[model samples]
Target: MSYRAPWWLPGGNAQTIWAAKCSRRHAGAAPRWRRDRWSTPDGDFIDVDHAVYESRADAPLLVLFHGLEGSSESQYAIAFADFASRNGLAFAVPHFRGCSGELNWAPRAYHSGDHQEIDWLLSRFASLNPARPLIAVGISLGGNALLRWAAEWGEAAARRARAVAAVCSPLDLAAGGHAIGRGFNRQVYTRMFLSTMVPKAMRKWQQFPGLFDRDAMLRARDLYEFDNLFTAPLHGFKNTEDYWARASAKPLLADIRVPALALNALNDPFVPASSLPRQTEVGHHVTLWQPAQGGHVGFPVSHGPLGLPGHVLAMPEAVGAWLLQHC
Candidate 1:
């Protein structure tokens, strides 16, 4: 993958919050999307939203995984969807369990290390685009899971995709989670995630009685507390530490065999830069693309003929170009 300095995007703070804070920059973006559902063996269903390019029915496929609490309509996913269609590639996003606006049937929700679901989704996609090259892209939470899957699958991961790009994944999830739980991150992003998480867990707890502590979940002031009470117990982990340790993908990066690209921002508020793996720590096939800027999944763009201000180029444009060149 190619790297370009973010001279136009100013500071790391801008790169991190650009996509969320600067919605006006991405106005008038509406990509064609369709919905499909897959039933899991565990009595749950996964909803896949397709960003179709009907003109290129036989073209290669691009699978996307959205960030924590994000859906197919997320800004980055929308950018990728439009770019894929324009480039004659079929695009689809696998919404983890309850993130599809519908609660899953089973009590067991997805975590950062849930490889079984991602594996199943890839196997299902093979039949959909058997003749063409396939690639997967993951953002934030989704990225962590994808890397773990590839690492565990080893050389077998090539069956799913020749290459994978993970943008702003929390490689060392334990450190990342704890980092977000303290100081400025606790006041901002941690609350941002827990605001969505607590209510959703409440709804799920209502569905599955005797499964979690409602009082503790309701009292959670940060993501750590919420995970300590809710995510850990429901997902069958001993506690938050156990969940984060097992779910993190950092330790597994050395085992991945597929040509993988992992991008992390030096100033990402959600993931501490210190948690990032050294270049030598990863597998020979894995390439780490740590742009000095790019906050979390934020890669602000600034290129237009008419001196446009709000519209920056999308992250998918660069990554899609990389896949096309590599595949």
Candidate 2:
């Protein structure tokens, strides 16, 4: 599970940042996604996109959970969809609360620990496809959520998904938030997140006037600031620190009971390596894949000096290989 960086992209930052850039540039034609609406118990709606392959009649289901502010259209999600479709698997990406390009009616938006949505999706998928195996892959923010969910569910989770894989998750949210606030991360990646997130929150405010404090959200600088101002209050946490403590999955890893794989890069800029859960700390079924290199969700971009496809496709390719052997 040690992912190698492409010869061209050296170090963790280069491997991470440049691979993301390449994925942005060459994700190719957008996949045709079928949008479906589901009613949440909270009186709000969530959007889920389905990508079907014509090749198979009853393919196993692969559920994908995207990063913060990302949707089915994200480059990595598209890559996984392609991988699923071509290999006799069906794919679906669940857009967290308001991230499906539509404003959710509720003032509450998604945070790092929304297990209700995960339960909703899993229950429905299991009901409809009684016999089909279920697999989940969570990336970044979504990855953390999935890991925590698995740990909480323990043996109960094993029945839902045969296997789970988390890629580049901020398992330790406090470390992650601080890491993104410092040095180049603050200037580039953190800024990129806030730029997209602030506008979305603003739109939600406009949609529910007087419900959310738009002024405070707009004044926030990065993830930690935004969470302190908007995310914490909306989600019932006392503050950002409280939210990070309760929401981080690192402490729960030892309890996870389902077959699972958690992947992280030693050089991942967003997730400090020191925060990753050690193998001995996790449950008997969990496996940690700390690839020496492979930035964020840019799996397809490269796979070490061994190198596969030119673009960022190595991730799905590697996952496919793993699934074939293990799942």
Candidate 3:
């Protein structure tokens, strides 16, 4: 399915903001959730929210990995969950470390290319229901990490999941990081992420005293500075430059072996279109969907009438269908 932005929601910023703030309100019929806390090998725990259709026990499982600081309740996550529920699919959203409304016990937190964690999670999920097909989808930061896992594991990745999809992910970390650190994006999006991120980092600092420079972290005004101070060092990268270079999924797109889809909006405020991969750049198994519209995760179909709000269901439904096709 193709996407055309609603006439009322023009441009990238408008679509992005509307989807983030209002999409959930129009999501309709909330799915019941069962939270499961799983302990990691590193002694840290991650919470997963599951929405299973008991009647369809043998159906394919849809695993969603959320974006930076995003949880199971994120607008995109909820939308995907609704899609799975309606389609008789089992859905799961695993919270990144320290993002489950509780601080993680480990000093190191999740990063944009935490493929090992992705590998572990998918492997466990696959083992839990070996008969059911597994389809994984990652959004934004989580998407990048998922692609990284697919690339790093090569053919082995197919053992854990039949297919994978990344929605609005920053495949080229350098381009995406620099883009989000400047202009109005820096003012609005960057600040918004730091607002929550800095406090969490400070809390982590309290857990491990002198883990990083608390004052420098406090002085961070953009994602670059914040990552340099916290994300990079905590996750074992030498610095922000090193982290962005090594963590990017773009350079390794050709290595992915399983059926994969990389969807990005051309005008995404966070991920610049120039950073998106072309058909020739990726492996034969990879599909690139660079729709001209749909800002970030926003793909509204129409402006609702009779005092209703526009809905952002087109993108998720399209992606969900694509994943199932591979299964």
Candidate 4:
């Protein structure tokens, strides 16, 4: 099933904003989540929320990795949880470090291309349920990291998961960074991210005293500057440019061996259409879905009176169905 934006939500920015602010009210029923905190190999703990229908013990497990600063409570996560519950599938959302309503003990926080973390977490999930099939989906930053894991693992990735999907991910980090740093996106989206991110970094600094230049981190006005100051240095990258170049999943799309879907909206404000890979650019096992109008992660299926956005389930449901088909 393809996406068609509601008539009231005309442009990409409107679709994106409305879905983020108002779509949750239209998300019907929420799944009952059981939270589990697992200790990472690095002595840090990551929280995972599980929604399982006990009756369907043999069902495939749908693992969702959320976007930057997003948690299990995120709109898309809840929507996907509802989709899994309705379909009788087991669902899981693993929180990236320091994103689960609590600060992590580790000196480092999560990044857009933390593929090693993805590899470890997913492998642990697979090991815990050897009998059931695993299907993974990542949104935005989480999506980029998941794709990196798949590409790095190649055919080896198939042993742990039947399929994978990335929704509205910035496959090309440089292009995405440059796009999000300009004009209205810089004013609104970038600021929204840094509002949470900068404070988090400051808290991390308190944990590990003098971890980075606190003054430079505070002066960061955009994602590029913040990443340069905090994300790159904390993650062992030389700088923001190095991090974006090495962490990007676009350069290695052809290396993914598992059944993978890279879905992007041509009008995604964060990810430019020009950076999206073509059919010939990826391996035969990979599929690219570049719809004309689903802005960022917002694919509004309906709209209410007076231009209020309604349900944003079409994209999630469609992506969920695709993952299940592969499983």
Candidate 5:
């Protein structure tokens, strides 16, 4: 396949490499976000990390989902929570399974299409506190998962949450994956994702010896290969192809009846501009924002006179305000 860099993936994916570099540059800079424990339906206890603003009673609840290889402690996660709290909204950042700083006991790991896990968490939240408005915000891979859930489950998931906002979602996962698989872009993501994922797979192997083909798992460096061998089979998908086919949000967008804000920059380094779905086709339920620049979450905020937050962090506010007005 001859790959043309999506306006997001600049210099034929050199920008993709730079995004990873910037992610590392700002890594570990986020403040300490709190962690909480919740029990799964299977009678397994799982630790879910979250960052909250103020008490849950007075404020509307906003749940956030982080990107690939991200946690509640990610800078955007903390910034969103901070913004929510400052504006009298309460929020929680749910760390994916095994990504919450504690190794999850369950044999399963988190994936972009893991709706059941999110369902379990939301159910718990509703049971504990009812009658409060709930909203969800997701970024990148997290955004993709939320979009898939909304598209697949529709009003069921929408009923549980008032509105959804997804930024930089790889809605067309297959396309996004293929886009990033080119040249140094492939190497950049493969290395970063594998660096974390391989260790986790290794840990799982330690707990359950002979569970995975150790050599094959090690050899799988990119997202597609690793996911096809491990995640797809475990999650009931025939393989990575099946998983990507089912999980990509493009097919489900028309089914989403609830209000949602989908924001992406033409210059985002992950998802290509052409991959962005047409908002008119999504009906009145979706709003698509295509900023000319952001560079895959690298919306640098200027502090000279106008103290505007980076576009990445300011997105929650924009969406939140829009939701309050529309929803």
Candidate 6:
């Protein structure tokens, strides 16, 4: 069957773009991994693991942020890096706190809208590539953070980065929680997320005995309750509603100044289609892309080595091409 670009992209060229430019078979060559470590303004040492492709010493840089529990090694990240390399673009993917095979300090783990880290990274990038065009592409939770940051920074962020792209993003945290908690999704995703999260929560309790209520933490069954009691409060929000209202990308879509794109699948169980902000609301600064099918961040069928499984996988190249054209 012929490929089709999601409805969000303009024109009919998305298919050709997907096949020729975005294909892993065409993206070319594996990239070498390198780590960039720095201290956050909050006094925490953080590292961003990057894979370089082509000569980036003086070219535009594309910084990628991965999905929940994803690092630079994620298929999407690697594929995007490979695509960037083939297109003569530079690329980097930052490893979220505690995700680079190291535990984070402080009892708290990373949450959506953590822009302080993004600030730390851009400052360094600016020093190196002051004149170089920069684009940020984030997936899933990382995407949510990027969008929130873009909304917060607005034109300042537009001035700092050439463009931003987010795929399979959970624009509304509460809506996403509700969507993911339905049917089989609830069991699969909730269980999987908690399996990874519970341990971290436990570690936090160990570090700050009085900071978190162990009783509530122990009684938590899913991400909603866990985030409501543990994540929101620790992160400075009053509660889950507050956190969701503040952190979700939907609220920030109108504030984006730099050219941006938010792609979500209608069937993505993790993010409700209704949570997506309308194109009219975000103004010309943002483009909304939605395909008929794609499960969460699992756009598995694309023109790649194993053949990208979902339509979501083709987003990076589309974003890269759009950036190249516009920036």
Candidate 3 wrong stretches, greater than 4 Å: 24-28, 303-308
Pick by lDDT: 1 or 4, better one: 4
- What digit string (tens of lDDT, one per residue) describes model 3 on residues 1-327? 478887778899999999899764235587778999999998889998897446466889999999989998888888898888778889999899999899999998899999999999999899997878999999999999999999999989987788999999999999999999899999999999999999999999999999999999889999999889889988889999999999999999999999999999998999989889999999798999998988888876665574246777778899999999987
Total clashing pairs in model 4: 0
- Given candidate 1, what's the lDDT at residue 199? 86
Higher-ranked by lDDT: 2 or 3: 3
What does candidate 5's lDDT look like per residue over 1-327, in tens digits?
Answer: 011223433452443343334332221234345667887776556565554335647467778888887877665676676666666776677777777766777666777777667677777776666866777888888888887777777789878878888878888888788776676667776687789998998898887777668899988868888887777876778988898888788777888877887887776657889889897668778888877766565444332344321123454556667665533
Q: Which TM-score value belongs to model 1?
A: 0.93
- lDDT string for model 6 (27-138, tens) is 4556778887776667666677766444756678888888777778666787788778777777787778877777777556678878766766776777777767888888
Model 1 over residues 1-327: C-alpha lDDT tens digits? Answer: 343434656666566666566633333447767899888888789999987447465678889988899889888888777777777888899899899999888886778887877788888898777887889988988999999899988878876787888888998988888888888788888888888888889888889886788887888998788878877877878999999999899998989998888888787878888999998899688888786776777777655564334443456777777767657
lDDT of 2: 0.80
Q: Residue 125 deviation, candidate 6, in Å?
A: 2.0
Weakest ten-residue segment in model 2 by summed lDDT: 21-30
Sorting all predicted structures by TM-score, with the top scorer first, yields 3, 4, 1, 2, 5, 6
| Per-residue lDDT of candidate 4, residues 5-122 (tens digit) | 8888888898899888888532545677889999998899999999745646678999999999999888889889888877888889999999999999999998988989999998
lDDT scores of the candidates, listed in order:
0.80, 0.80, 0.90, 0.90, 0.70, 0.73
What's the count of clashing pairs in each model shown?
A: 1, 9, 0, 0, 2, 8
Candidate that scores best on TM-score: 3
Off by over 4 Å in 6: 1-30, 302-313
Residue pairs in collision within model 1: 25-310
Q: What is the C-alpha lDDT profile of model 2 across 101-180, one tens digit per residue?
A: 88888888888876666777788878877777888889899989998889888887887888888889999999999999
Instruction: Indicate the worst ten consecutive residues by lDDT in candidate 5.
Output: 1-10
Evaluate residue 11 in candidate 5 and report its C-alpha lDDT on the 0 to 100 scale: 52
User: What TM-score quantifies how close candidate 6 is to the native fold?
Assistant: 0.85
Give lDDT for model 6: 0.73
lDDT of 6 at 13: 27
